[model samples]
Target: MTRHEETGAALLSVLLLVAVMAVIAATALDRLTLATRIAGSAATVDQGRAYAFAAEQIALRRVGELVRRDPAKLTLAGDWLGRDFTLPLPGGTGRARLADANNCFNLNSLAAETAPGRLSQRSGAIAQFGELMVLLGIDRGEALGIAGAAADWIDSDGNDGPLGAEDGVYRSMQTSYLPANRKMADPSELRAVRGVTPKIYARLRPWICVLPVADPVRLNVNTLAPEQAPLIAMLMPGQIAIGDARAALAARPAGGYGSSVRFWEASSLARLDPGDIAEQTGVTSRWLALTVNVTMGDGFLTAESLIDANGGAPAAGQAAPAIVRRDWGESD
Candidate 1:
């Protein structure tokens, strides 16, 4: 218990202090390294997003040129309908594809535009949708029920169709959510409607779209692929079979029909009664979608832009086609 003992205890204390300081320094260094890594990842994501946006602009410009070059007809003559291309960016790369977005059945068509900002159940469109479901292998009664439910969901009324549900019915469900009673902004909303099982949704996803308008479906016949022939068949239910529709599309001229009349005149489509469908078919597309994917370092970015080309010819100084909507994070 003398000076030696005191000195030994002091030495032990100094070693313990050194070990504690070393642990603290190590922990601080680890946290700094982690923060620096997180910041780098964020910067990389931002760069990728920037590249994706640039690619979208380029796609829009190309679409503008295409529409201006030929306002009357937009054909697959140059393989532009589903064109895939790539762009090189500094320290990254961008991939993009342009597609005719109006070739599918517009789900909003279930609701007819009676007047500006007014909507009602569109019986004809509902029938067509049901026909489409039947063509996709769903039972006819089930298809009609699903179509009625979809119409009720968007029709701006509380009265439900015979096979559909309204707010009262929805309120009685286990989950308890009311009908939107408005046009859907995305086709995914169909999942919320009654009778639309996940399996049914998967079957319908590829052939349906939710355009931003309640107008009846207007399909560009020239852009319809063989796989999309069911859309044509649905327009003329009980007349043109799906196989015949595909045959009609297969027989389409490489340069595309000069007009909807020529399209209907095709021998393969002669069985289709053009009743009101002629007004719904066209050679020009009104909507196009651009999907861009960017890869930067360890990050990835995806974006989709919906362009409405209903604007008159850009060559005439009318404002070029407008980008009505843009979505980031995922492409549908």
Candidate 2:
């Protein structure tokens, strides 16, 4: 080949090499930028979580202070770190709220014999649960059976009713799934109980929850949605329509039920079976689930807090308060 041609070819090869190197450099830069962005996002999420935790600590401190001042005023709120708060809970994003631990049932208290055998433990509350089950399209017998199974699952025993899933029954239904004994650790555990179909669970999810083994069963009238009051009313024998319950409640002025005691003692309860009413109502100290909607500037964070309400002080700057569950909820 001629010298000139050879020189031209060498130059071409060098140009090609330069192009390749340029491509590699560009790709590396893009990757570095992407990684940095990812790291920044992670840090932001971490910061938000940290802030949430800080807010929880502030909430607990406020609860202690409020209770010390007036235990009956547990549902009051105060401002902290630029956020407004409350209990029975408060109202802001990145804020924590407390529910009276006394407002729910300790799954541990459920027993085939001693449990009121009522749906909601009020008067005809079980009948209301049965109604909801029917409303949700489950058969009456199936609905009651599902409740029985749920009761059996959380009742600290292995005894199985005809419809309940003891270990043997659960093992027979599905090869991969097993059953649990003793009390449930969380309300979600109910999904694992036999006879509780997914659809029924979906219907009950918003209204029901599991409390600590040490807690007691008490319905919170203030927190209950319209759908739940019927069940509470149904545990008694008198017929209770959802409309009737809502109307009776709406008739009462603000400050939902006077004291928790007065809440249950209303004249509407006179029609309910006293024995069943006694067993199913009232709260305990160890567990609570509160649905709090908070407004932070222009944004909103609606959160449900499952708390362990005790007398001890929380550590500084941290609300590591006993959390059975803390999860994101949709805005109302």
Candidate 3:
């Protein structure tokens, strides 16, 4: 080969080597930048979580003090039922709200275990639920069906109620699964029941809850909002109208009734016999929920804690209110 051609070949080889090195260096730098961002995001999330948990502790202490101070009743006089507060953190901020969690229908009330793991439908609760559904615009027949299905979902036996489904029915579905045959850990589980469509679930979400136990629902009359009059109406069905229920709630004393008896004795509510529900209804709350939201750097965290004050007064020198459950990511 000629000298000139040889020289050109050498230069081309050197250029190609430089280009390859440049590509490798660029890829390494890009990877390092991505790794740094991921590490930073993780750290921020951890910090936010720590702040959220600290806020929950503060809420627990406050609730304990309130319940201990006045064991007889919990009132809305101080606007404490749905109180919201904010806290300043070193490099972020936290927001929290406290709410009475028992002022809703308990879906678990539809059935209670007659024997260990054996559940039987509670006619009264099912009737009340059916009434609530009807008041909410659901067809009466469909409402009863949903209630029956809900009961069957929690019962231990394979037998289904009149309008309910069993494991066999579920197994035959396009996407198959079996009934829980157990108490629901959360209200969202209702979405899995046979008759609860997404729309129906959304409609019912605001007025119902799932307590761990299957005992009858005990709504705190003192905390019921005027907008929640349907809950009161459902309890007695034909006896009370929604407007009357709302008016009664609106007329409640600022500090709440001195006792459940006083609540039942109110002029507007006195005429109707609360009957079986009289024992189930009360003016004191047993459960409260605290929602905490924390933001740190670019990270955000949300958490909810369920506080069980054991209802009514704690024995003298009893331990502080207990946090029975905690959940992250969403609020119910």
Candidate 4:
């Protein structure tokens, strides 16, 4: 109740106020620190995505360059971000790589229809298509039907293909599955065809492509995969053995057979009947499908490149592009 007692009470009040201020300040500091960390993490994720996008652009440019040159000279491992990698595409942060188109079936070739024996190359293409189906574990008859359906899809007319699914057959299905009257706008449309199951389509997706609706089918030997070598060989007359083409491939570079002409230049190709080599080499009437698989950290971008023996770049652009397909996974 005296002056000293009152002064003491005032000091206690000030001390309590200071303690409250200190506690509030500490809480605010903790929140600010957490907010900064969250912002930093978000920035890192966005940066990784941007790096992946840049890698895709680089891959497209490389594919365009290959098509400009010989499709055979393309390599995924050369000087990308100052290091080497494989063709299926380099897998790492801030990097993307591409795979050559020669490894896949040229979907455009499915349109050709000259009564069985007339166009030998065309017939060979049909057989090669069957071979591709076989590699995917499909039966020969089913392969033939699927290929024939594709033919019906591309040809201008409405006739049924030899295996059905032509206008008549497809139009008649009670369930109503059939070949399209025009070339496919997208490869996924193949699912609508009679024999192509989801499983079959998935197996064929990597090895086959339907691009640009306008592109033709020209098999690029330089881009052909080992499993697809036989199809390329079959496109030549005299039915070159799959075993021989595979052997010839072993001697070539890991990417592919190199130039198509170089593929013919190999002794193994020469071993085929002279007439067969003459028939296969230098035929560029068909279109070739070039797939550029660009993989960046945490992302995958695919570019479908169509090459003319003459030359040209893909129509796809550098922007927020629509994905034909994409997948993601944790890094090792």
Give candidate 2's TM-score: 0.67
Candidate 2, position 214, lDDT: 29
Residue lDDT tens for model 2, 87-141:
2222224445455544433334443234443222221333444555665557788
Question: Measured by TM-score, how close is model 3 to the native structure?
Answer: 0.92
Q: Which candidate order results from sorting by lDDT in descending order?
A: 1, 3, 4, 2
Please provide TM-scores, in order, for all candidate models, with all chains considered together: 0.91, 0.67, 0.92, 0.57
Q: Candidate 1, residues 189-209: lDDT per residue as tens digits?
A: 999999999999999998898
The global Cα lDDT (0 to 1) of model 3 is 0.82
Task: Assess each prediction's global lDDT (C-alpha) against the native.
Answer: 0.85, 0.52, 0.82, 0.54
- Which ten-residue region of model 4 has the weakest summed lDDT? 313-322
lDDT, residue 314, model 1? 36
- Per-residue error for 205 in candidate 1, Å, reads 1.1
lDDT of 4 by residue, 1-332 (tens): 99999999999999999999999999999999999877866665555455555554555455445444443244333433213333433343333334433345567566543543221124445566766787557877898888776666666666565664666666677876555566566667777777888888887886776544332345545434456665555455336767777666665665544455666667777665544434343322123333333444444544443433223323322222233333333211
Residue pairs clashing, model 1: none
Q: Which candidate gets the maximum lDDT versus the true structure?
A: 1
